[model samples]
Target: MKVFTTTLGEIGNQLSLRLDSKYRETWDNEKGDPIKKTSLNKIKVADLINRLPIKRVKKGELEDECNLLSISETEAKYGRLVNSIQPVTSVGSDKTILNEAEIIVSKLVMSKGYIFTNEESSTDLIGSTELIPYKKRKKDIDLTFIRHLLLLDDYLKYYSGLETGKTPSQKRVNPIDFLQLLVPNVPYDIQKEIGTKIRKLENEMDELKKEIQNRNKIINEILATEFNIDFQEVLDIKKPTTYKKDLLSINNSFDLRFSYKFNAQKYKKLLSKIAQHKVSPLKDFINEPIRLGSSISPSDYDDDNGEAIYISMSSIKNWTLDKDGSRRVSEEYFEKNKVANSIKKGDIIIARSGEGTIGKVALIEDDIDAIFADFTMRVRISNSHNPKYFYYYFCSDLFQLIVEKEKKGLGNNTNFFPNQLKRFPIIQVSLNQQNEIVKKIEEKLEKVRQAEMALVSKKLEIDNLIRKAIV
Candidate 1:
C-alpha cells in the first residue's frame, strides 16, 4: 500500500487518511481537513454564536451602513481577500456618530463572522461582528489567546489552503468547518502571559511610530524656518485643479494649461503673487531644455545581468537610481534608440508618467551609459546652480506639489508634461544659500533616518520572536 500527502502538514495525518487526486485537487471540501482533530477542545462557529447562519444586512441597510465604513464614508474601499481583516466596527471610528445612549452607532455591513471592524476602532464592537460581545467576554477563556492561535504562521497557511475559489478575491472560507477545528487548550495563566507579551511588543511598535511622526514634524518646522515663510502660510497654498476646460491664457495657446479665457486671469493672478518674491521658473538655471527619452522595443531589452543597461520608470526611486530593478540593453540597441538621450552624471530625471509614479525625482550618479526611460523628463544643470542643492530642492515637497498640479490625466496613465515642469516655480536662492539649505536639512534628517532604522529592526525582531513563541 502507498500513501500520499497533499500539503506540508498533511504528512502528520497521512496514516489516518488516504486522499485520492480528485479529493485533493478539489481542496477536499467534502472531507479534507485543514487540521487533524487533536486532543484539544473544539467548538464550531454555531456553538459560540446565539445567531447561527448569520445573514448579511438588508440591501437598503447595507448600502447606508457600508457608506459609514467606506473609505471616505462615500467612496467604496477595494481590497483583496488576503488584505481584508476581520473588522471590529464599534465606537471611536473616524467621524463616529454616537447614539443618544452614548453607545456608538457604527454603520457597517458585516457579511458572516469576518469582514468586521479592524484595529482602528477600539470601543465596544457592536453590530453583527461574530465575536462574543464585551459583556460576554470570558476571563477563563481569553479570546485574545484565540487571536494569537489563529494568527500563527502554520495555522494561517492551513487556513489559506482551506479557501476555495477560482480567483483570490473570490475565495471563501467555510465557517462551520473552520470553527469546528481545534486549538490547544491553553491554561488561563498561560493565556494571559502570551497576551501580555504580544501586547507589550505592539506598544513598543506604537512608540516607534510616534518617533517617526515627531521627526517628520521637526523636519517640516526646520524647512519653514529656513525659508522665512510662515509654516501655516506654506500649508495654506491652494490645491491645484485638474485643468477643467483647459484655461488657455492671454498667450492664446493650449500649451499653457492656464489659457482658458474664464480662468486665464485667475491663473496669471496666482503666478503674479510670486512676482514680488525671489522665486523664479526652474528653467532659469537649466543648462539645456528639458528632454524626453525614446521608447525602446521590448526585443531590444537585454538581461539585467548583461553588459549594457537600459533604465525604466521603476529605476527612479527615493532621490536615486534603483540599479537592481534597472534593465539592460546591448550597445547596438542603445545606439538604435538614440544613445544621445542616455543618462549622464549630474543629470536630473523626474518620472513624468505612470500610475503612482509621476512626480518622483531622481539624480543620475555617474552612470553615463544608463539610458533614461521614455516616461521621464531629463535635464543637465547649468553652471549657475549646484546640482546637489538643486536635486534636493526638486525632491522636496514644494516641488512635488507644483509637479502634482501639472498632472494631465487620471488613473495609471496619469502624467505631467516636461514643459510644465520646466516652468515650475522655484525660490531663486544663491548657489551658496542652496547648498547651505541642503546641508542643514539632510544633517538633521540623517539622525531621524538612523533612529527610524533601529526602531524598524527592533520591530522585525520582536515580531519574529512572537510568531515563533506562539507557533
Candidate 2:
C-alpha cells in the first residue's frame, strides 16, 4: 500500500544492491534530509568509534572464577553495566573480551545497549557474541549519549529494516550496517547534560516502583488477616515424608489423587483452617458448567482489520484484560466458538496453562466481542454470590497457593484442568458481608491504581524529554 522511488545513484552510494520495498519504504520514511539540513551537525556512527574483533574463548580456557556478561542479564534502555560473576564452567558459549573503554550494543534488539562503567576492576570483562563491542575513537563523544541515540525510534526502524535472517526472531543487524547509521552531533556538554537528566528520572522511577511493591505487600497482609492463613508460612513449609498409605487415607475412591504436590502437608494444614469457617467447593456456586476455550490455528489469524479479538493468556494481566498484543480472528471463527468461549459481564477468566502465567484470574465487567483461547477457562458465578468478592479472592495468595499444588505438567507447559478448578475451596460468607469485603478491597486497590498511573506518566515524560533533546 506504500510506494516510493529512489535514484540509481543513491543505490550505488549505499554500497549494497538492496532494492526491497520494505527497506526502501523505511529509508524514505526515516532517512529524510533533516539529519543533514538541521542546525545541529550529524555524523555517521563509524566516524566516532572503532569496532572490536570478537575473540572466542573456550570454557576450559576461562579462569576458575571470572565475571561473565550475557545479553539476558542486561535490561533495555536504562541499564548501563553488566555485573554477573560465576564459575568458568557455568558459561554457556564462547565470549568476546571487553575493556572499560568499550560499549556493548545488542545486535538482536535495538533497545538493549550498555556501556562499561566499572574501570575499578583490573580484569577485562567477557560478553556474549550477540553483543557488538565498539570503542570510542573521538575523545569528545559521550558513550552514554551514543547508547541512547541508538535506541531512538527513527534509527531503530531503519536499522531493523536492513537486518538479515530467515525468521523474525533470528534476524540480526550486521556490524557494518550498524556503524553506517547516523547520529546527532550535539556538543559534549549537552550530551553529558542529557545523560545526567535521564539518570535522575530513572532514579525517581525506581522509587515509585518500590512504593508499588510496598502497596502490594499491604494488600497481601489484609488478605492474610481476612483468610486467617499465613500464605508465606504455608509456602515456606518443607515437603513432608509421605507413603502410599497416606494417599489412600485421604481418599480411597477412584478419583483419589497420587501427586505429592497435590497432597502436600502445607495444603492440608491450610484446608484444615478453612474448615473452621463457612466454606464450600467452587462448583457449588457456579450458575453453569465451567467452559474451556477451543484452539484457533495461527493460519486463521487476521491481524489486519480483523472483526474479533483473540484473547490469549497474554491478554489477561494484573487482574484485568489487556487488549494490547492480543491476536485477532475472523468473525466466522468467533461465531462458531461463541457458545463456549464468548466472554460476558460477571464472568471470570483464568489462565489454565503456562508456567508463570497459570492461575492468573480476571473479572469481565463489560460485554466484549472476543473469544478466549484454549489455554484459558471461564467461570460464571450464580446470582446468589457477589462476583466481585470471588474475583478478589481468586486474585489473593490463598487461591494461588492452591493453584501451585494442583497444576500439572513440567516447565512452561503446565496445565490446570476444569476438574481441579471446580474442586477449589471458597470461603462462603453472607451476601452483605461479601459486598462489604469487595468495597473495602476496591478502596485500597484504587490508591494502588493511582500510584501506577503516576509511574506511567513519569515514564512518558522521560521518553518525551529524550525525543526532544535528540530532535
How displaced is residue 308 in candidate 1, in Å?
5.3
TM-score of 2: 0.77
lDDT of 1 by residue, 86-160 (tens): 343232322322111111111121111132212233322123222212111233644444444444444555455
Q: Model 1, residue 11: what's the lDDT?
A: 34
For each of the candidates, the C-alpha root-mean-square deviation to the true structure, in angstroms, is 8.5, 4.9
Find the number of clashing residue pairs for candidate 1. 13
Model 2, which residues run further than 4 Å from truth? Answer: 1-37, 53-75, 82-102, 111-129, 166-170, 214-219, 237-260, 263-277, 294-308, 327-341, 409-413, 429-448
Any residue pairs clashing in model 2, and if so which? none
- Evaluate candidate 2 by giving its C-alpha RMSD to the native, one decimal: 4.9
